[model samples]
Target chain A: MNSEETITKASVEDIDRIIHEPARLNIMLYLYVVENADFVYLLHKTGLSKGNLSVHLQKLEANGYLEIMKEFLNRKPHTMVRLTQRGRDAFTAYRESLLNILQ
Target chain B: MKDPLLEQVQNDVATEQQYRDGIPRIAAGFFLIITMLLQMNGNGNTFVMFVPLMPTIIESLRKRFTYPRIGYAKVRDRGSMRKYSLWAVGILLLVGAAVFFINQVSPGTIPQENHQPLLLMWATAIIVVLLGIMVFTSRSNIMATLNAMGVVAIANRFFVLGLHRDALYVVMIAFGAFLLLSGLYSLLSFVKEYPVLTDE
Candidate 1:
């Protein structure tokens, strides 16, 4: 393989597949802009259904990309989500690699 | 190449649900009107005390009204906030210094009778400009509001250029009223759009 092909392969490989999903990408993008957000806010902003969002959030939490907290507010369950430091670094790397590949 | 996702992120941040409630604009409007009233009543110095409380008031109101509807999300402060704040303060000081310089250079240029009102007008202009910069973060129909503010600023400049003393009050009132109406309209629309979510 040529040097250019090798570079392209490296760039593609650097992409974080966990964050590359569309719904989770939307969640990450939304969360990235704010310090923290509740499940309802994420649901509203990401336009993801409850089940889908919960699943993606769980995957992200499992990957150590998200920190989620659960509490009862007014006798109703409320979940707050924020990005971990690892998540921010990973997202930044993923973005740089994706841009490099596109370029 | 421009990244569309980044653009969308910026758009989303600028038009966040918290900013959509028009609380900032409403607070700005109240501040302007209150300052104008205080100046008119010869209690101008008291208005300064209210400046520091503005943010607290807005935050409290948001907690009470807006957060319940859309949930809480603290936006990450942009670096530009400090830059804009510094620019606002610099412009305010520059205006004050220029006025002082003019008075020292030629006391006759501005009649002693008009000096106090002129200072008040300049102060009002500075407040309007600062509010304009602050509200630019929302950027939701703020272009129209900013354009209105721009027109007032430009017109105020024309009055100052012409050395018209009485025209300043009219300009200040007009700009303040515009912000008041704009904020009221936005707040009404926001309330209509987002009813408070009941506890599940």
Candidate 2:
């Protein structure tokens, strides 16, 4: 196989499919820093719409990468998300795997 | 196809900075006031000791103000925290040594009745260390010019402009007060601009 084909295969193979998706990847990466972030905070960071953000966040939660808490603040709904340990490990692995690409 | 992850990271970094924008000025101003208050009480090495906690105070204020508006993130990782811990230890050691030297060798390294220079040294050191943290950890430059102004204000205390130490402290204190007020104004503006849309 040509070097280009080989490179593409290696890159694609190493990428973490869960985190490789653009939106989930962004969500995981951003939450990795803070203990937890609110819905608005994440929304601002990702610039995603209410519906799209909810979908991506649900996906991450289903994957066990995200722990979401829904609370009522002043009779209004509030959502906070934390990156799980599993998620952090996945991200670390994802980052390590992407070293070649980043460089 | 653009790196949305990198973009989020960048955007969050900016948000963190915006959240912390005016804090350095407030901290510097706080230091100045504390310096004056300590001096008024005859200093006695007690007041100077709390200077190290400036970083902690800055963090506390940031959390207090930022939380009411936007939420927080653990800005530093474990590795980064360890690095800061080592630096904190090193700084404590350095300050301890300086304090010990001053107590034991006073009238040798530092002459009596010239306290402004001593306060000047503390002010500069604290601001530089605080500014370093800002530049490195949070990437906040909002206080860059104000930090410089603080140093200049304290250093102005040493000039031969015919100002007495008391007079100089007053001028320095004025600038410090103004800087802090500016910080408060910025903080209030931030609160207004970004009304808490979420209970989080």
Candidate 3:
């Protein structure tokens, strides 16, 4: 393949991996569409158990793809999450890169 | 499952949003009182006139409790609160301007005799305006709520003092206590809910 094709192929693989994990990808997608979501809300939407959701959320948060805030509601625990600027930008870029490869 | 605590939290969020939505009307009422006060011969008594409106404000806030807007996808998912806050701020400015015009028309009605109280009112109003600006520009809901409470407390205290009523001191102390407790609660909850993700 030509140098341009080779470079494009490499970028496509990167994008694919970024969005390949079902749990992490869904988390990103949900955050991308909504401005912010709490842990309960995310759990409800993703249909993931509390423990499972917590683990994946930490992974995304560790990558700087999400900002998490914990606050109490009626003395009980709660967690709120929102996508960071970098996360939003990266998600957009990843989608565009995948689209380019598909075309 | 069937969690009453969850229900209560939902109610609180709804109540807060409802109170926020009514800010425009509350601001208008305050402006009206300020106008009547400016027209009165004894501007010092202006604070006394504000007492009757206190019930109205409280009632409006209480109404918010029954109408919970929490957990719904539309209200919770979007940042629409910021937009509503901006609209309320605009309405407040419009009403404030109208009140200012009344003050200008009735010179000396403010009783230059004790400009200290009037100065305090002006300062409180300025602070409220600044807080409203912050609420409009930022996404911090908790900060906005605290700032709003400050606005109400300041207005009430100054107005009551102007009327020679010392009861506001008790009210202010209670409010301060409530804020301290709530702040500590929120901080602790934040720490517990999301342990720091260390893998960055």
Among the numbered candidates, top DockQ falls to: 1
Task: State each model's CA lDDT, in order.
Answer: 0.71, 0.65, 0.52
Cα lDDT of model 2 by residue, B1-200, tens digit = 13566545644564464444567667767776676666556573564576678778878886566655555454534355346634643563576467557757655444355545555545554554455455344333334433544555465446535455666556656766886898788777876766554442
- Residue-level lDDT tens digits of model 3 in B46-69: 554554464565445433421222
Chain A structural similarity (TM-score) per candidate?
0.96, 0.85, 0.87
Every model's DockQ: 0.46, 0.37, 0.05
Q: What's candidate 2's DockQ score? A: 0.37
Q: What tens digits encode model 2's per-residue C-alpha lDDT throughout A1-103?
A: 9997788679869788989989888888788766677887777667777788899989889999989999886677878889999998898888876876666
Task: State how far residue A41 of model 1 sits from its true place (Å).
Answer: 2.5
Off by over 4 Å in 3: A1-20, A30-103, B1-80, B113-162, B165-170
At residue B132, give the lDDT of candidate 2. Answer: 47
How many pairs of residues in model 3 come into backbone collision? 1
Stretches of candidate 2 off by over 4 Å are A1-17, A70-78, A92-103, B1-19, B34-65, B78-111, B115-163, B188-195
Consecutive 10-residue window with the lowest summed lDDT within model 1 chain A: A40-49
TM-score of chain A of 1: 0.96
Residue A19 in candidate 1, Cα distance off native in Å: 1.7
Candidate 1 CAPRI assessment class: acceptable
Query: Over the stretch B70-101, how does candidate 1's per-residue lDDT look in tens digits?
Result: 67776666666547655655756786798789
Identify the runs in model 1 with alpha carbons over 4 angstroms from their true place: A1-15, A69-79, A100-103, B1-4, B17-19, B132-171, B195-200
